[model samples]
Target: MRHLSDADVEALLPPPAEALRLVHDALVALSRGEAEVPPKPTVHAPGGAFANAMPAAYPARNLLGCKWISIFPDNPSQGLPTVSGLMVVNDGRTGAPRAVMSAGALTAARTAAVSGACIAALAATGAPAGFTGAGLQARSHLRVLEALGHLDVTVYARRADARAQLMAWAEEHVPRVRLRVTDDAREAVLGRPVVVTGLSIGLTGAELDPSWIATDALVLPLDYASSVGPALARASVLAADHVPQFEAVRVAGTLGEYPATTTWTGSLLDQARPDGRIVCQNLGNGLSDLVVAAAVADAAEAQGAGHPVDTGSA
Candidate 1:
């Protein structure tokens, strides 16, 4: 078996354009019933922390993998990342583990790549975008947006240090993209052609107002309804990356009062862009992780990255 660390996974990630293409293909396959991805099952911990087991199989792409990831909202208080875990890539024919790699970077990459796919399919380019969180997911999204040619952006974060860190990172890594940091969430989201929310999930009293969204804007919420809220979600033409997963969460009350008119995001990709505000709540599908992880594993094998471990069975 090949063992890949977080650094290895990060180094082996596909380019932004290629990542976007992979995610796009995965979504299309999912919508067409070409992929098998069961809804992720979760185990809870104290203080609203939980971990999920996400598994998927895309035979058409020759991909099969499972990701075990945990999200602890209070990790930052202890100077730790909020999300962490690992993924195991398995041989499609034999169902034997082939590679194991860190999940943090892969999760962030696939999530943002999915959002990039949404932006390309639903929103117009060259317009200033807005983001409401400044964590790893937000930074990853910024990189993807930069690759998509959406260079001008506004970001709103509650912590001064976090905002400053994001600005500094952008200056060094995504230098072509200009960032405007703000303390006001309204300033970050209102009237933007594309707006993304990555706030901590399960927060009460969601603040964004539906009226602030433009009539023709694309809203991608990575934080469930934590930042976008029920009112804003209800006001838009809502969609999700996976309809069944979205419904599962809605039935579990994670998405409070979300409209029942939700459709599959991939279904809208090939159709004409719909009018009025659109909100595509991407709950992060396992199929995307599987596709990207398979790509990473293939690249690692080709480039002689990651150390090998004996599984004894083989």
Candidate 2:
């Protein structure tokens, strides 16, 4: 087995546009039933922390994989990353495992890719964008948003330091785009054509006023139920990576108080798409991880980013 660190995956994965394209194709394949996405089974810990298993098979990409990740919200206070995980890729033809690699970088890259694809497909170009919680997801969204050629952005976060840091990073990395920091989340989010927020998952999350959303803006709430309140979810046209996952959970009576949603059935490329204030709160699909991890595994095979371990030693 070959092992790839997060750095290796980063160096090997393609640029943002190419990354977005790859994941977009995977999602299309998913909607067409060419992929298998198992429900993510999360093991809950105390203090709202969790670890989950995400397994997927991307036959179109000729790979199967599983990513095991842990999200401990309190880790940051302990001077550590909040999310950490690894992915295992297998040969599509055979059941043999191929590679194991850190998934931190892969997660961010593919998420940005998926969010970018959503924005490109649903959002209008050259319009203002806003980000309501500045962090990794915010940065990832910005990277792909820049790739989409829409750069005028307003950022809002409770922490002034985080907002300032993101603005500085954008100025240095995406100088062509204009960046503004705002103190009011309502001011930053309400009227923007594109809004991205990373408030994360929680049961007691503060309720949001849905009227803040523009009539036609595309809101990508990467954080699941936290950023988007139930009011917005019930009001907007909803989209998700995999409806079956949520459906299964809902059927099992585990989706407590989750707003009503219908799974999106059409292709990601379909011309007749959802209109009005659209919300994408995709329950994270494992197939996307397999598709992206497979790419890094292929690159690792070619560039020798990781070393092969002798099976006999195991």
Number of the predicted model whose TM-score against the real structure is largest = 1
Candidate 2: give its CA RMSD in angstroms: 2.1
Residue 120 shift from truth in candidate 2, angstroms: 1.0
RMSD of each: 1.3, 2.1
lDDT, candidate 1, 118-177, per-residue tens: 998888877789999898988899999999999989999998998999999999999999
| Top lDDT model | 1
Give the per-residue lDDT of model 2 (tens digit) for 1-314. 79888888888777888887777887787777878886788788998888889988877657788999988777867877778999999898886788988988899888888888888788887678988777777777788888898888888877888888988998887787788888787888878888887764553453456788888888877666666766787787876677777676556544455665665522644556666788876666788778778888888998777878765533
- The lDDT for every candidate, in the order shown, is 0.88, 0.77
Can you give the lDDT of residue 31 in candidate 2? 75
